[model samples]
Target: MKNTSSDIEEYLVNVPEERKEAFKKLIETISENLPSGFEQGKSSGMIAWQVPLETYPDGYHCTPGSPLPFLNLASQKNFIALYHMGIYADPELLDWFVSEFPKHSSRKLDMGKSCIRFKKVDDIPYELIGELVQKVSPQQWISLYEKLYKK
Candidate 1:
């Protein structure tokens, strides 16, 4: 269920009213913790936090036109998805999240390499997510992204 809306407000309008607050909270957590240079708006049909094209003109390796994504949040039919690039770029961060999240959250950790699925708001480990979001600065992410592409 990919919503084609490019505006964050338009995208949120597609989100069910009941889940809107949760989505906003997720946005807040990411915004509060994200590094100083990342921009927040819409990208990839969702609310994306990223290093703007002006900041890193090289963009994503997979999509040259798209900005280098740091985090993305979307409301789906059944759940909300938070895409955290930090964990994808750094294996140790993923390892720490997998081992530590469950200790603080009752919900089982549901995640892929970069996407963390939250079936309910409570399924989100907000504090841990914030910590993860803050682990890398925008400059750091560019370095990591560049390093990966070099290989």
Candidate 2:
């Protein structure tokens, strides 16, 4: 069954107390590392941090006046996934990810026009991930996005 926002929240709430704490820590780390102005919201059952409307008036759909997400985090039945939006738009970044984190197979990347799916918290390189987040300030990311995804 496709999970919804409520479902995901409920799942997180019911996790073993220990795991729940770990999840919270992970969430906190992500929030702390992300650039300012990235708002968090529930979208399609996942916790997402996205570009503000002013930055991408059209949203993730690349449509005007739509609410879109650039990144998402979710706890699934078996693992957690962190979705990164730049994987598809920034070839250099993607290449860097592959070269720097060679242990992860290409299959781990669920490439969309701008999404990188990472299963399991351990599957990610937290330091590098933080660097990725820091590399493009929120404003810069939005501006680059506008240029790359002009519609």
Candidate 3:
């Protein structure tokens, strides 16, 4: 189910009680370490950090006028999921994250093309996620996105 909150803070307030603290901490970690040029907003009901439309006038091709999405965090029914567009677009980054997962946590990585799922709130590797959040700048993400989009 999608988060229906129009505002980021409201979305936070609505997170299920069991996942509240970890979800908030993960959000805080991303906010603290996210590279410059990204703006925080709500996208498709999830909390998103994106390259602003003003910065990248083309916006998201999938949703005209929307910013170019970088990362999104959602509290799903069973897990907290972080969707990172860069990891989907960049193979090196995906490989790096896969290789690094074991060093950060013992729990097996639960992931999809772009979604990294943390089933146990306490199992989330906040430090590793913080580092992952820093690996891509808005400009870099835009360039990577364009290269893939143009293909």
Q: Which predicted model would earn the best TM-score?
A: 3
In order, candidate lDDTs are 0.85, 0.64, 0.93
Off by over 4 Å in 3: none
Name the candidate, 2 or 3, with the larger TM-score value: 3
Clashing residue pairs in candidate 1 (N, C-alpha, C atoms within 3 angstroms):
none
Across 21-96, the per-residue lDDT of candidate 2 in tens digits comes to 5566656777888888888776767777777787656676545565656677766665556667766667887787
Best by lDDT: 3
Better of 1 and 3 by lDDT: 3
Per-residue accuracy of model 1 over 1-151 as CA lDDT, tens digit each: 5778969888888888878888888888989988799999887788999999999988887887778888889887788998888888888888988998878799888878888888877567778878888899999999988887644
Evaluated at residue 57, the lDDT of candidate 2 is 68
lDDT of 3 by residue, 1-151 (tens): 5889989889988899999999999989999999989999988889999999899999999888889898999999889999999899999999999999999999999999999999999899999999999999988998888889944
lDDT-based ranking, best first? 3, 1, 2
Better of 2 and 3 by lDDT: 3
Ranking by TM-score: 3, 1, 2
The alpha-carbon lDDT assigned to residue 56 of candidate 2 equals 57
**Candidate achieving higher lDDT, 1 or 2:** 1
Q: TM-scores, in order shown?
A: 0.92, 0.71, 0.97
| lDDT (Cα, 0-100) at 52 in candidate 1 | 90
